[model samples]
Target: MRPFAVNRIPRWISGAVLVLWAFCVVYPVFWSIMGSLKDNQQFFNGKAWALPKFPLLWSNFSYTWETYHFGRYFVNSIVVTVGSMALALLLSATTGYVLARYTFKGSGLLYYFYISSLMIPAILTLVPMFFLFDTLHLTNSLTGLILLYAIGALPFGIFVIMGFFKSLPRELSESATMDGASHYGVFLRIMLPLAMPGLITVSIVNALSFWNEYPLALILMNDPGRYTLPVGLAVMQGEMQYRTEWGPLFAGLFISMVPILLLYAIFQSRINEGLVAGAVK
Candidate 1:
């Protein structure tokens, strides 16, 4: 009914932008898949985007595993990411709830201080954090990585969860208190259940980041066996520089992404709910 709504040029431009973005994402994935099927020689000779002309080589996965110690790396990544996400969510939820529900001196200033970290580039703190971790003997330890990741993820997680908690009806907590429920009981039983969607969103986002983290792992972790998947892949490429085994490299990259995809698939509904909740408030 509106003139702008009937505008063809705006619709066409928006549609074109989406198409371009889709191509940018899809083409690389398609190329990577194609590359995984081809041997090194075939990858070099064949068209970059075309599928392998020969039967798919299943052995690439085996070679990738044996060569890179990928299994160990994958396990380490999972352990670190899951551990960090759990700690971060637990801490962030408590902090967010306090900020959202309580009115105290400098609460606004406290939140400003917390969320301000998000605006700072991570690279700026990387060196300082590394130095501090070294002083505390946290370098090259999984425990150290987990702690740093959890703390680093806190700002954004708290911001998002705080927003969600603020949007919640305070009457629910009041009602629970009227029934003689303690603060812990109200939070643990009532508020947490309602905040599950936001927590899931934060968890998924943090997990993805911790899983794929490269620069931090590269700086902190020195043991080859303790390397996370991203660092391991980098090491693999470095070790295999002469041969350039695109097949296994692509395979490893594809496999590394599987867990994240699975997490998204499983918690997809909650993730959507959290996104909508954040936007609505």
Candidate 2:
């Protein structure tokens, strides 16, 4: 069709680059799966890239699940992630709608406050949060982490969801109002559903953040029983100095990876759609 399109060398080079990138991304996951089925000796002695031999060790998963209580950690992660996403979405949707649709005194200032807060690093507040959590008896509390995660994600959520709201035509709201829809009805029935792509995008963002969150969870959760998956993985890694259970370690990692990977894979298109709509509108 064109010089660039017909150029075989460039096409070949581009294909090569893509293949290399794909391999780089895929190999680690492949290796991890293979490694999860191997003993320490097989993992070390066999070719690093080789698939596990027959009689694959499924015991690694069982051992990690039972011994490390990864099942507990998995449940904890799900609770925190789902709770945080739900809370954050509700709060962000309401706040973003109000900020985006209604203009009153200090509205701009309020939006800017969130913008500025988003820029502030989370690490800077860790010391303050530690003391505050202790004072409030929130340490090692999953509910407390849910609230914190929701609040921590609020700024970004508001930023994204607010754009979605702003992009929506006011005619939809005005017409719904003319039909005797209350403000809440208009928002719930009309505006919210219209913003589904944005909501999915925001949920995915918060889901990933809360699921993989490390430093905050690590610092706030003191009780081993309360550990989220990331913290649990860290605890597992820490045991490596004393016990190098490579199989179980990879199994733990793979377990932690599954939900987030599946989530992203399913909703990734929505993310792109929402972002593009937000930008365009």
RMSD over all Cα atoms, model 1? 2.9
Find the 10 residues in a row with the least total lDDT in model 1. 272-281
Give one digit per residue, the lDDT tens place, for model 1 in 1-281.
Answer: 65665578888998999999999998887887677778977877867777786688877887787776888888899899999999999889999999999989998898989877777888898889889989999888999999989999888788889987988898999999999999999999999999887888888877878998999999899888779999998887886668678899988887787887798788877666555544453
What TM-score, over all chains together, does every model reach?
0.87, 0.93
Scanning candidate 2 in windows of ten residues, the lowest lDDT window is: 272-281
Q: Global lDDT of each model?
A: 0.85, 0.90
Residue 215's C-alpha lDDT in candidate 1?
Answer: 92
Residue 145 local lDDT, model 1: 95
Off by over 4 Å in 2: 5-8, 273-281
After superposition, the stretches of candidate 1 with alpha carbons farther than 4 Å from their true spots are 1-21, 265-281
